[model samples]
Target: MIYNFEDLKEIVKSKVSIKRFNHIMAVVDMSIKLAKIYNADIEKCKIAALLHDICKEMNKEEMKKICKNNFSEDLTDEDLENDEILHPFVGAYWVEKNLKIEDIEILNAIKNHTLGNKNMTLVEKIVYIADAVEITRNYPGVEEIRNLVFKDLNEGILFEAGKKEKYLESIGKKSHKNSYAMQKSIREEIKKKN
Candidate 1:
């Protein structure tokens, strides 16, 4: 089940909507650029970006089913109910089980793209930031964050994580444990650099 890049693209395209597919392509483009800048594995970034949202279009029931089946111990009832938060876990599992992509970096990148984790590899950071700052993404402070990412990945991630936490609070949603751990890890990294 090893797919060439084009095969992967086609599979992703068929699985997601046109808008979702466009976002995925933008993420792929941004990922490659960040990978080149950060000296990460470009192919892994490409693969991770392509499959990051592969299960985004799935119905909530199906996503919940997948999460329950594969990540039952790792995810909570709230996590499984939140499609926005649930897709990454399902995406990673789907990519591994269906697409036969066994690369741990790629799978973790896909899994961590949504909420992020305590210790993200270079490839994971590339995919995570690229998904946020891709050219098509237009948010209030996205331009500033995008600029910050190219200059310093850790700072950019820290900023984005803070924003995500605030946004979730604004919407009356609790930030996931992984996001908090990631922010803590990135903050420590920034502290070391300073």
Candidate 2:
């Protein structure tokens, strides 16, 4: 895909609120740094990170309608069934349809950045962690996860996933099945390593 950073940034800035736009920029910076350490494609990382939340402000009904075709199969039943939480899929689909990205890995990273899947690729994992620990984000234990990012990508991913779980419970929201499965898989991997 031909990804022009300026064009992508303009499109994103035009669509999202200032706070979200800043978050997107932070994720882009973090993604690029993590991509270098993790040996991911930097250009793809840039595009995916910038566009990850492009549809965050979009209405759920519109997302659901477009997702009928663009996001039907890849997302979990939890995602497909719940209109409220389908931003990741909607973002991925909208970018592909509008930008002609033509890179499934980039699209996949955007799709899974919110609550990652067990089968996530390196690019996906980088984007997910970057989104969680981006400099703009202020949360408990975020510093530890930020430090762990380049030092240990797997542990960083697990840490962020666990933090996300706690945040969900505190807010009285249920995590997607992918979040649980991803956390379980990461825990097992960390255990095996230890």
Candidate 3:
């Protein structure tokens, strides 16, 4: 039950691997910056970023128990089968149940950070994009996406989604349905702009 900022850091440090901790720190820094740029609630953004991957390293059996205990429409049985893709949902529920956080926006940001949603809020977008473009992330085109985010958030979102889809397809893996839905929504929004 990490209630405060310090407690959050301490818990994350103790639980996650060193590499994951560094990535979490990077997300915290980047989420704060993006929160300011996008006029989001910085507190919520920080909370979301800090706990976004709370279950990332958990074994599938452990994560499955958490989901079964707290499962809802937001986290269905089907979602539990794919812990790799549905970790965000577990993280979100864990935050709410364990940390006693009742902020829907923060919970939603955590829940949808990985796959995204149809109409994402600024905070949600910030968390999702921050997790990808944080300084520690060094995949190809990350710098380009980082720069794009500062200039045009929606374009950055589209680029990230497109990149993710392409990578998944290249590996013969189908992206979560939510990702495809969000991509469609982003494309539609981009179409409206052009």
TM-score on alpha carbons, each prediction? 0.95, 0.87, 0.89
lDDT digits (tens) for residues 1-194 of candidate 2: 57789988999999999999999999999999999998998988888999999999998778877777765665655566675468888888888888888798998899888878887778888888899889988878999999987799998888777777888899997777778877887788779889
Candidate with top lDDT is 1
Ranking by TM-score: 1, 3, 2
**Any idea what lDDT model 1 has?**
0.91
lDDT of 3 by residue, 1-194 (tens): 23588888887787789999889989999999998888888988998899899878878888888777765655657777888766887788777888788888889899889999877788888999999999988999999999999988888988998898899899987777788777788778889989
Superior by TM-score: candidate 1 or candidate 3? 1
Can you give the lDDT of residue 102 in candidate 1? Answer: 96
Residue-pair clashes, model 1: 0
lDDT of each: 0.91, 0.85, 0.85
Clashes of each: 0, 0, 0
What TM-score does structure 3 among the candidates reach? 0.89
Give the lDDT ranking, best first. 1, 3, 2
Q: Model 1, range 86-166, lDDT digits (tens) per residue? A: 999999999989988999999999999988998899999999999999999998899999999999999998898888888
Model 2 CA deviation exceeding 4 Å by range: 68-84, 187-194
